[model samples]
Target: MSPSQTLEDESHPSITAVNRRIQRLSLHLTPLPPFQPSPQLHMLECAKAANKLEVDKASLQCYMRGKNRELQEKVINFFESRPDLQTPVGIPMEEHRELCMRQIVALVRDAKIRPFRYVVDDPAKYFAITEAVGSIDVSLGIKVGVQFSLWGGSVLNLGTKKHRDKYFDGIDNVDYPGCFAMTELHHGSNVQGLQTTATFDPITDEFIIDTPNDGAIKWWIGNAAVHGKFATVFAKLILPTHDSKKVSDMGVHAFIVPIRHLKTHQTLPGIEIQDCGHKIGLNGVDNGALRFRSVRIPRDNLLNRFGDVSRDGKYTSSLPTINKRFAAMLGELVGGRVGLAYSSVGFLKISVTIAVRYSLLRQQFGPPQQPEVSILDYQSQQHKLMPMLASTYAFHFAAQYLVEKYSEMKKTHDEQLVADVHALSAGLKSYITSYTAKSLSTCREACGGHGYAAVNRFGSLRNDHDIFQTFEGDNTVLLQQVAADLLKQYKDKFQGGTLSVTWNYLRESMNTYLSQPNPITARWESTDHLRDPKFQLDAFRYRTSRLLQSVAARLRKHSKTLGSFGAWNRCLNHLLTLAESHIESVILARFIEAVQNCPDASSQAALKLVCDLYALDRIWNDIGTYRNVDYVAPNKAKAIHKLTEYLCFQVRNIAGELIDAFDIPESITRAPIAMQSEAYSQYTHHVGFQ
Candidate 1:
């Protein structure tokens, strides 16, 4: 039964027909022309599709798209104009990198369309522009992310006014392309362990930067292989050798280091650069590694807003503790985490769009008296896909809230607000990216074999997005960061210490439940109770509170015997669960708030159902946890299951419309089976099936 032996003889009739049909399909298949949907067209489609949503279609689309509908179209149109921007199959990796670099330059060169220039002037527009571009091509999205969000952002957030005045204009106009050099080969998530050193030399009034070993080399740097002329390098700032004595480490600080000659595009002396070579996806990005041997930059090159070195080489910082200062410095890059989360959700939308479209057009077995039915009509398939469709909507609103929070945080230097933003960003990035990876895999399976083909785009998307799970921050590690913050809040509340207003509701619930004589269990008489946003939020809060308390008890028990680190390690699993609950609470609250605040009744009603489905689905999945904590009765879990089934069916009818609200460009989807305009007869005729 080996493939070679089997192929030596003529294939069976069914196999022959399948092969012929595939050949015919291949003949008709071609690269899709570039496309970007106009905002008007997007609005019009929503209008036509509103009946399915039980809302004002145009209004819903506008609300769903935020205020960036027009900007999104412009982004699409920009990509459509440059075919080379598309990451075509079979192209040489080197050529792909070059084309991406060229397009990035062109996009940023034009004064009217230049995206980086707005990073400081107008952050909202900058975010919208980056999201739009990212939605089109992740490779392009990441290039922009590295240049503006990372390298340029480091200057905006970490550097002082002096650095801004010197580099802001050049950064916007692509005068000298740069990379964010932070992750070293051995110390990515554990950033504190990075081995690169920048030691101040008083005699020369310069900092001598060196990658002490191979492990300290900056690896996986976007724009590093070739194009970047400079980098914002993060290293342990070693105090200057002074007073005939050794100086201590000053902790991690960012420095503007020139790695390449501006004119020649050649690595400067004492710098070695090498490409990371091929990767699973996102090949167009020129990811590379860098090693420095006594590279020298002037003292002023340090990005010294938070921490500075005096002319006499004394290290000083405004923050009280080195850890606090480092945290503050790293917090400045929270936008990267936020952007990646947004991008993950965007990728999810496209994945679901292609899967839903394919399921609609693809036909399968039916009764003898009837024609074949679309796979979408089958309950099993709907069960797999519709919930993901609903989740896309849920995360969409949550991401919007996160983006707004980020914007507000940028305008002020409020400490508590910064911490809240950090926890939320870290939590959501882990939640959304992990969900996206699973959803994308499911979408690929939903498409059956066709999804495996490169032309369908899922393979590229899945591979490209897979890295996101670990890139900005490892999802598991990020969740720990979230959990650690939540635990602090919980402990503080119990000690009668001040708690942030952000934790007010959760804290109040904890106090109320702890004082109650009996545990609060689900008491809804009917599944109808599941649809109430207040009920759903309350139930979520109850479960989250119980879990938080459980985690607290477990940690306290472990701490008495095992010591701090050991206790944390032993309870890591429960801690992650606790973090997930807190995050889910935030998502539910955001979703409910969004639905309740809608101005249009119809839009509100439609979104209400969408929100219900998202919340109910989550509860249904975690019924075991709910029961474990005595937060829900067995009967209630059963009721949740029934309600979940009903909501899936309810969501199924409007699934297409829900995805359409995402307004993903057809050009971006690029799946042959997703073409609704093509007649089945053409396919049948080509296959000689008629």
Candidate 2:
């Protein structure tokens, strides 16, 4: 054969086979199926799921509203009726401040909602009105809080009857807008370290208030920028000894200082007031920095509840030491933390409601040739929002319990009760506000691009709530306070000292969990086992107990080397976890109690479902801790994860009714996407697309 003919005949068999296979595959290939047309089901499935259960929204609303429903309704209605009180979408900072002031003025003058009158007599009623206003407009809520809760509360709680008689009516009527000046530029969490000085002048019977330096300037004094005429200023009390040259420091005390002219609203002499200017949120609050230069006030201006100063420059207090007196003073002011925790639930309710409602209405991808399903139907979306929805309910009950305890504390003035309420308020305030601050962004993202629009309220809500974590007390520092109390109680438990109701769990958990040997075969993975309230509570209680024991040991072990402060710093993260675990247990306990106390079966069932989700979700999130300690076996942990998703689905079915139980008015929610009907149309109108 010729060379060319032999080459063609001897071609690679692999290449020939690949070419043949390609041709065969090409011959078998066909065009893809045509894209299916979108179906038009008119959201019937969403409506069906929304109305799946007999949620009894009214009964649930009444239950969630807690006490003073009539008063809360009145406050909500008053603002809802007034169009001017409705926060506009876009406005200048000065205008927003003016609007917030006007809203508060109307609330006091026109609506006649006087929280000051009920501050002591009916604290639940007081909190109801403040919380309601907060749900309406956060700026107005905070302005109301500053004027009534902080400034007015300081007078009522820290001062004697004479102070109330002088300032109560003025504050209630907005005749004298006031600021609570406790936080200095450099001293926010440490009131004991405040640099401002109030030196007694026995000859004049006056207190000369002086800011020692710029760091001593009172910063973030709400209402001081323009509206406030007076301030409840906290400063160190100094008493002059017999010798003209010697002065004694008497710790911190509150004094009423005039910051501005009451009639002309001019900055008072010796008081330099500068506006904090525009802020990320709460521009409506007129926050200002105040510098006092030897400002003189009558000796009577001293809020003499915890301590008193004689005209002869002598200091007297029933509490023996400065620390005890300070503790008592701060205990009385615990209402601020209580109110923050309470109002945070309101903000969470609004944000969750908006996110849930929008999720129900917003449809995305679905199976071909079928109507697009609501985002809420997607497990991913449900995971993002359902847990938050569950937490809102959990925090609601916890806040209500705190309010009741605080009210009882005020009435009884029992030392133990006061201490319990103080610690409880701190933990809840820190936990709930921190959760809310983060959840607001989650809610914003859950709503997709629409949430970014200012009209949806998420941007403003997130910004306004951002300060909540730091203000009442910085969350980290507050959590440390809780852990310290825990450690104290833990030590006291061994000394035969009785534990308070809040810490009683420590005793039982230490006995039941720490003393018992670990059982290798206790991994119950059934749905009932996972959802059982008893099981959930035990898990929570166990985690807290173990953390308490371990952290205490860690601190003790490290103290020998690192010293006390260094050891504390080294164990700080563990302490925070311990505090948070304790708080979660408390929240779960409160939630279970609320569910058990519900009168309506349908509402009880609904709340129970949400409560289950809250508990399981918490456990699932911290499952690693449970597994590492062998508290939960792998199978049980898997069951918890599965049950959490199952509970989310169960809760998602009635997400609409659950949010409706919050009963946040459309006027308050103000987000067009949160509307019950024609949401798209309302959104279009809101965005000026019409």
Candidate 3:
């Protein structure tokens, strides 16, 4: 056969089968009790198809939707096609967990879910795939995330070629289930204080890994209870001394340790694993606690990309400082934070879709002798949900930007780039997850009693996503890290003499504005001035710069009396505010850039409205910050309020269209109210009070 014909012949069957399956699943996955398309939904779909109101599904979805639309659709279709993957309302915890793990394994076996495995063409695709699966089932998403991003990721990123040669293929195929053993019973975010120890032994040329105290036990380890055979363990490495003992000052390192016997599926010698019991949500993940008692692993088990110990007990590393080495090691896993943030966005999108659609269809109070109006028509409902809808878009584009940065850093491994990625990821992760948690909760409340039902999916989304704010580094701690980085940037501008564009671009760009007389003064006269993207950018930049300056001054003043830590503690509230503003500015800038690059005029126009709402709402929320800096007069503050309400009203009309642009599948939405139904009486009588 000719080359082209041969390629076509190879591709035809798989493509045809996928299409056939999707076609078949669509019929099966349609809402039960039957649903009729609402007029608004019909118009939304028509507009999307015509590109008159497209929202760049690739950007929103964070996958190569253009190139991988088939894969994306197939993944969604596969889940909708499988009832086994769906959790029963009140099943036994163990049974629920078993099914969850099984479903996760099924996804791992699917070709569409394979993009989440390591070494994909694009890192964003990894995040995109996880988010898509998560939108349907939070349990499966967490289970797969634990297996792939956390466990497989630690091995792939931290371990050497020898480790990869032995483990990657098995991990990729799930022949060996693994857990990331980082958080301890006593220490979660404070990795440096973890009590687990790996002591080097010259005589045996091995590392003795131990959880000496109860506090040292690995806690919240997904896959460790019953499925995992191995773990990438993080422990303080104790260097062997000539005085017949090992000391722990050497620093922390990651090691490959066997936790369970593969053939028997039981705890290995010197290891004990116990289930973490049940949780409010994501119980399907089988989170477990692991304790090690002098487990022996070979010297080569150390993942020594940044540091290593010789057989003779000498410690060596290319990086001089423990902090630098630690930063580099953790930076390799920032992908986890990025993934969590995007997954939270998925939850946000799903929640808002259910809430808004329900609001439009389910009506409540209205005038006497008048038809009951949709709850969405009420301004209160708009205030509660519209801004959240805007934020979902902001996070979508911001996540894409972070994914692009992560992909670039993975290729280059530049030190400055790594630092910037760590800082930005830390900030964005905290911002996205924190906002998503609040947004999800708001969505639930907006939907009234019906949202509390397990079937609605919002309750589970809220419960499952709650962990996001606490894990992958606590949001509060991560925000502090962002503040610290900003403080460093402020110092670097004077001390280092040169700065990278990522952290320092604002510094350079603001010089012109900072030098002008009354640079932040907002003229409240014209709509063109108020809504101009440039004006919005300037307002945000001014707010962030002023906050940073004020915090720096406070810190410096306090440091004279208190120690550095005490000084920082004294000004922490201000510092946190500065960090929050800085993160908001970063998101706004990235969202604007994405909007500018959009090729379609209609999409741009619609997206610009969402983008404007995001910016204005943030500014309106921080009016006190603007007032403190004299950036806006009282009249301008009122103008900001009026503009925000007006923007929300404009965006509200296209809210359904915007949700459609997210391309959420009805099967995943899992809420009947979100789907259109001609039997309004039936819905009002039955599902209304659930």
lDDT for 153 in candidate 3 is: 84
lDDT of each: 0.81, 0.89, 0.79
Clashing residue pairs in candidate 2 are: none
TM-score of each: 0.89, 0.92, 0.88
Q: Worst 10-residue stretch by lDDT in candidate 3?
A: 1-10
Residue 316 miss distance in model 3 (angstroms): 2.6
**Quick one: ranking by lDDT, best first?**
2, 1, 3
Order of candidate numbers by TM-score, starting with the best: 2, 1, 3
Tens digits of per-residue lDDT, candidate 3, 153-211, equal 88778877887788887887788888999999999988888889998888999999999
Q: In model 2, where is the ten-residue run with the lowest total lDDT?
A: 1-10
Pairs of residues clashing in candidate 1: none
lDDT score, residue 180, model 2? Answer: 97
Backbone steric clashes in candidate 1, count: 0
Which stretches of model 3 miss by more than 4 angstroms? 1-69, 110-112, 119-121, 245-248, 512-521, 678-690
Better model by lDDT, 1 or 2? 2
